[model samples]
Target chain A: MFDFPEFFSFPLGDWINITVDWLTLEWAPFFDVITIAIREPLVSLEHFLWWLPWWAVIVILAAVAWRFAGRRIALFTVCGMLFIGVMGLWDETMTTLAIIVTSVAVSVLVGIPLGILAAKSDRVEAVARPFLDGMQTMPSFVYLIPAVFFFGLGKVPAVVATFIYAVPPCIRLTNLGIRQVSSEVVEAGKAFGSTGLQLLFKIQLPLARPTIMAGVNQTIMMALAMVVIASMIGASGLGLEVLRGIQRLDVGQGFLAGISIVIVAILIDRVSQALGRTRETGLRRGG
Target chain B: MRKVLLALLVGIISISIVLSGCGEAEPEEKPLIKIAELNWGSARFQCEMAKIIIEEGYGYPVELVPGITIPMLQGLRTGDVDVYVEGWLQNQQEAVDTAMEAGDIVMLGFINNDNWQCGFVVPTYVIEGDTERGIEPMVPNLTSVFDLDQPECKELFANPENPSKGLILNGPPGWECEIVTLEQVTTYGLDDHYDVMNTGSSEGLFASLQGAYDKGEPWLGYLWGPTWIAGALDLTLLEEPAYDEEVWNEDHGCAWPSVDLFIAAHKDFPDKAPDVAEMFEKWKLDTPTLNEALAYMLAIEGEPVDVAIWFLKEREEIWTQFVPADVAEKVKAAIAEM
Candidate 1:
């Protein structure tokens, strides 16, 4: 009774491996297609980003920053980009920016639809909640190697790992936002004989926009964190720089790269967070 | 005459635009041949050497794919990586044997079998007491691994998290050295007093040692030479019972066996690039030769390419022997131009 059956064993890992092995065999072509789908845009975007004259990019980013994030943030963005340039990490910074943008974009596209569906249906939320929990809790390292097996170890796996790690907050936050919409307002919409689709598109979505924007911010943060860990699988960027610094025991190099990552993270965070409030503040211009 | 001159100038400018394409020098193919790079310095430096020789002497573009031990070994088996400049034979013996048996990868040549050792090591400052740093020897009487079991020594190096047991920094997880170090501690019956910490990765181990070294702290750990760390820092390798194959196989009670280092290739590599493969077969490096390069890299903080260039520039007699006269001349010409 105390020992609780010494012979009893679970084959959880073995089953997972078997499943992965089967998937690799049966889904090689499918995985390759998905890999290309992720890789093509990422590569082109990276090339385009790096190809732009450095000052041109800095100017564009600063302008965008000014539009939503205010003059202070705009100034900060310029200073950060200049620091990155001065440190001779301009090309690597562009590559990292491309990765982050692509991954966050992917997460948003998939997450919002799922979140809306979950908001409409309690059953879907119940089903997705455990997976979202798992995704958030699962160490990014755990899936990194498997991601390589599926995506063949490069930027594709890095993107896949990053999106998986980052997508959960996007989804859960969206769900919360939609659910938090005032029921009285929803009833008012129903009283006007508005169809369900009309209510969702016009009222519910508009009400949830700020919250969804928060979700996007969270996703970007998570993506940034996972991108650093994804360096182990050959994702070159500031992450690789940091890793090289560690491998060589070069403290200054590691700190420099870590500082660069922090700078990028702060820049992305402040800009996105500010962008979220722009509409509420009546500073949104293009809208 | 003015109209003619203007037309000529315009023609010249148009021709230059057609030729220049904004100075995009027609992309010289970026590394179709993938060479696996593991974490350590000597292996990386050797691969850099091979990459240069292959690119210059053999005219094939090569790239170093950053990978860890097991994954890169797996990559070699699956035909994902084309070459391994320095594959550890002793560390992953079983895995390498299995891969070779399956014909997934083949040993192209020996890389580093120069009777190097890996075991418990301490900074020389720990033993000698660095006068410059105003540090006294923590365990002046301690000399061998056996001395670590003493009460004072154990208390001195006690684990910060669990102070009941002392700490010994082992190699990274999944590393053969980590397993052996763990086993050796148990074999010596020192497990009751000491705990082995497997630093998560090679960088983790290196960083931990660095952190300790910077503070002039006492660190007992597993480390290997022919690395920049070994070259840059003065460390003392603790004594163990001389390596006995029977004892090591039975209980890992003895020191690490100096096994042959090997250069391996994907099974299909010979067919894909036969000349490069032949050149690889001739490519050899000793620990001292690689250590010199690692030291240079440490001093200058140079890239692998820079070190390789240094080697080509300085050690012409060494590399010139590995290739044909024509190939050597070609490489020399390339180096001269570079």
Candidate 2:
């Protein structure tokens, strides 16, 4: 058998620990600001969703579904909402929705810029490719540890964890969408004396709309998937219900919560896909 | 060519059939005892140890299934699992009550009494300054949970998020301690000065403490004994009012009651495997003995199964007393060979 000396140990874990400790100490104020920024909107959104009458929310969602996805999906959306309410998971479902919304919102705000950078620069793309792959491939639960360490426990950390887990798809798709824009169209825009910003907004962005929408759709789904795991770090709602169910072995409660999550996922997915398709057709027709 | 191919195929089938027959000729009734392994160290080690003994000693095949408290209890009910070596009954009163009412599970015996203790704890450095580590005494006058009432003492544990109020780290969501600690905070009127931060898991709680301890920062959190973190860390259990059953139940202001860690089995367990059930009745461990094993696990950073084997090899006198002479010899022989 071969042997290795103790002196060869790199102590990577110690170095990570020291770095985390230093970061936490040095950037406490910045973290606090992030916590408040995320927490306030999440709290307001939860309250707004819960405060509205059930019928009102149902009607609103159905109308949106109808406008985007047409009659069949609209019907499905109404039924799903009713089922969620009947199963007595309405508030929990809303809490989960609020979390997904907040996480996706933050992920988009941060992710889109990175996607643009990666699309424009070969060097940036080279660096970002592996990082995005790591983010996508890493188990969502692993995010919760450092999340708790940095944000403390509760919805803030949960949102942070969910954002990290959900952001990769949006970034990847956005970059891909931008790169996939027809080179001829870009050249034509440049030949017409369009500014760089004008080209990006008027030509490339509109062309990439469908793919970016797909990215948004993917980001939303990933965020929802992460909701349950985020409950481990104190994000309340359907995830907590599921966690409670597992803890007490309450099969009924767990199944109902899980079904509610699926229903919510379907509603969001249909509406977003519909919106994307509608815009895609309009672009084709106009062209 | 066709005739030769048919003959080859027939010969291969015949050989496989003979081999399969030989494989099936072994004992047709070897019972598999399914034991539940919990996430925590103590439960994992205890169940693994039992699994090794039952397999080697009684010649009963065993399977270890990993699960948390609730699902494992459910497994016991539905017969998915045959035994759970460490059942913290008090924390799981509701589920235990329901199962007992249905007559689906039975408490075998206490594994250890006074072995499991849960309460508020502070790093020992808070009280006794560590000169070698260059850590100052942050809460020198802190003697009891009551000392937290003092503004200065409360300030010592102030969290960055809520600097106005000190934070007391509670157990994870859905744990029995979370509810009890929440009640205690309200009852003690400490909620005004202290915010109860419920950690995600025992791992989360321990990490918070470990991070604080490494930085020589003051921390206050709910913790228990016979755990690797407790056994390894230098922490001081804060004093509390003596347990008064009536007051404690209604208000939960007093300290946590000592937990009787025990083994529990499915109702049909005895009928299905009488010998194993009987062996479970005799299985018992003292606090120091269990703590020592947990400490060894911590020191070597060993997995539960490996630690169980190590324990079996080292603690022959303790385990041998539980089983008959022949079975004991068998287990010892198995360990020796390993």
Candidate 3:
């Protein structure tokens, strides 16, 4: 038998434990602030979504679908949402939707600006590229540990984990979108004596609209994907339903909730995609 | 994007096909018994022990399939797994009852009698002042689970997020203990004084306990016996009313019942392989023996399979009691050579 000497052994686990302990003690107030900030909006969104009548929600979704995608998808959205309601999962679906919306909103708010910074500065790009790659490639399950340690347990940790897991694609795409704005267009903006902020808002952003929308689309999908994993840390929704199903070994229940997730994913994916296309078309026609 | 989507779809379909294809017909000469491998140490070790014995002594190929309790029970019902080594009876009573009623599962035998215990626990220091460490007892008079109803006691374990109500750290959501703890809170009329905070997993629950223990903070949570945590930590199991069969079954508050880990098999198992079924029925490990093995694994940080192998080699006398003389000889010889 062979073993590493005491001196040769690294104490990475101990170091992490110490660091986490210290942070929990020293920054308890900061963590409390974060929890309140995230939880208040999340609860309100969940309540609002739950408060709306199922038919009203379906009609609103259908109308939005029709406005962006067309009548066929609108009808599909209505049928799909109605199916979820028929499954007795409408409330859980709404909760999951609220989570996805909040996470994606946060991801976009944080990601787009970081992406813009990365796009502007080569040094920032160099720094952010690997970080984004790491965030994207790291197993989403690994996010739950630090999340639980930091936020105790509940929707806040779930949102934080989802944000970390989902923000990368938004940032990557935003950076790519802005970078892909043609240099000639940028030169034209400069020739017109446009300020940097004016160049971004009036020209670059409009030209990069489709790609940025794609980023939002990816971020939304990624956020939706985190719903089930987040449930493991006490984020309530259809994910918890699925988790309950799995815990009790009820295949019928598990599959029903799982299919509900897929349906929700498809509805959100299609709507976002259609919205992106609608914007692209609007920009193309207006320009 | 179309090409990428098409490629992904094709890859998924082909992989699924290949996976489905891999479950080809077994050779008639040697049958395979699929054993369920659970996440915990004792369960995994017992699974491997069954696997090794069934393979070597009985001349059957054994496959250990890793799974959690619920999915494994489902597998047992669906004939995907032939045997599950340790089934905690009360915790999984609902699932087991439905499966048994449906005639898909059979209880083989008790693996151990009155070996499992679960209840609210707190750091010993909560009750006993640690003079060496210069720490006073947080709740010196706290002994019974009912004592948790006191506002002073609740204040000792006040939840950081919800200071209005003390938090009773329950097991993960969906665990039987989570529901049980919540019911206990309600039944005891402690709902106003305490909130059942469900941790994400056993690990999370223990981490919270350990974190508080490290800081000499008062903490209370649900925990079970024959676990590494209980073995390693100096803690006290809060007392409750003595077990009552009628009261225990019908939503009454009482101490956690002493659980007997049982072996479960597919309903068709005994008819298909009577000898293996007989061996399974006779299989038993007393609490101390099982605890020793679990403690060994925890001490060495050894894998379950390795622990199983060690158990076979070290404790041949105990397992040999379950099998016939010839089979026992064969198993002993196999272990001797290993």
Candidate 4:
């Protein structure tokens, strides 16, 4: 079908598979430790999510949504949570929420610093750009096998899958945010005999906060997207229900799970975006 | 100052990473058979059954490695997984053929017995109206696969998406059944009458069928027996000319031969663990019995271990034959203890 001969094709898939087997052969115990490390946080997060009373969770979410996104979204949150409970998908929804929260938290923790570093150095950005692009674009299926191979098929691999897919935008956006911080502000800080640390914390990061928060929002969305694929492999929750609906041809079931996901996404999105908006307005008033 | 702060943060992150790598003890000294625990009711049930027998009776450890089909098949090929308890012959033929022809994997005993059916299936209500449900028959005269070519068939499934042709869904892409089904569609001269729609996976097919079944709408697509769907739904296999292997190899014009799924393993499995291999060779599950077991599995929220325990407790006559009398006694004792 091609105009050119296919002889020069790179066996990237074969190489990746071979590397996975090789890594497994050499570092099985190391990967096992990592598997446990991943499992511990995931389990704790799930427990914490489950520990909160359903009513308390709803009230807290509504309060947060109202404070940030306004009364309309707050009402939406209450209705959405009620629908999830009514559909008997409370446990599944909570599990999914826990996974998303954990992955998003981890991505931000790792991403922002690397982003700061990339923002500082052109060489680092040059190196990380391709890898970040690859992370974002490379189909999760390509890494899914290795993730399962390393973590042994469950929530751990699911977390790892999300971390890879979702972290890139976090890092990239943080880098962009910091770089876009005005040089005039940096010069003013320096001229005032401010130290590098003080300048970065006081001037750069504050200005970059909105952008970083936007990155966090993107990471959350990506994590939600990746969770569905991960569940198809092993991790369970709303995604598993969706997969069940797909496998069983239960349109009603699929729609139910899908609607639940959309509700969760919208709640998180509106609140987070508003968080950034509020801080920016506050900064303007303070300045 | 910034450099010091960055260095501190880096050090803290590194320490945390190292500290979080906690203890997960490995037991590689006592080598265990790894069973590929595929994510399906019947397959998982079989794996759990085998694990119990191999561990309790044979005194060898066994572990279930959870994964989907393709990776697990690769695991079998590479000996990462030592035992795979279910291999559908036609469905996975395209994937397994290369390894099989090369003798990288070994097929042992028939797991499903010689009892399985597969073809274009439609709900009984699609042909005959459910008077109680107040639904009229949509395609009552549709008996054989070729009857789909009837002009009335298009009127039955007319949708905004496709105005000219009715849709008869096919199997997931890359499945051998999809290939055979498409050939049958062309051969029966129904290609013009119906658009061959590919539902991305088995889930896709089930979803479409389920959506139609719930609404009492017509559906015609490839499906197999001994599944939860087959057990739960009232489906009738559209009539086909009896199976002719010669005709099938040529153009898939005839019916599918009764499928027998075999327990397969890495080629070295037989030589390394002859007893386990032999046990696999003698394994068999009656069709109706397995279907009931599948139903019970779904009833209990799709936990195959619970199904395995129940299967052993109930179907003593079937599993007892898989192992030797002494090993069977051991399994019995373990079961009794549980």
User: What CAPRI-style quality would you assign to candidate 2?
Assistant: acceptable
Scanning candidate 2 chain A in windows of ten residues, the lowest lDDT window is A141-150
Candidate 2, residue B215: the lDDT equals: 59
**Weakest 10 consecutive residues of candidate 4 chain A by summed lDDT:** A145-154
Q: Give the per-residue lDDT of model 2 (tens digit) for B90-111.
A: 8888888899899999988888
Residue pairs clashing, model 4: A246-B203, A247-B203, A248-B206, A249-B206, A249-B207
- Across A220-254, the per-residue lDDT of candidate 1 in tens digits comes to 99999876687666566788678666544456887
lDDT string, candidate 1, B1-338, tens digits: 99999999999999999889857653564337999998677778778877777787777878889987767888999989999867778777888898999999988988668846688999988778999889998888888999999998889887653477898877654456767788999998889999776454555456556645755778888887667888888899988999898998999998888878788999999998887788778877788888889899989877777888889989999888788888888888888876
lDDT of all predictions, in order shown? 0.82, 0.86, 0.83, 0.81
Clashes of 2: 0
Which model scores highest in TM-score? 2
lDDT per residue as tens, model 3, A37-130: 8887887889899899888999998998888888888998888888888899998899898888889888999999998888899899999889
Among residues 3 or more apart in sequence or in different chains, the pairs in candidate 1 whose N, CA or C atoms overlap within 3 Å are none
Docking class of 4: incorrect
Q: Please, what are the lDDT tens digits per residue for candidate 4 over residues B106-131? A: 88877764555788888888888889
How well does candidate 1 reproduce the true complex, by DockQ?
A: 0.02
DockQ per model, Cα? 0.02, 0.35, 0.24, 0.02
True contacts kept of each: 0.00, 0.32, 0.25, 0.00
Give the Cα-based TM-score of candidate 2 against the true structure.
0.84
The parts of candidate 1 lying over 4 Å away from their true place are A1-287, B1-31
**Model 3 chain A worst lDDT run, 10 consecutive residues:** A145-154
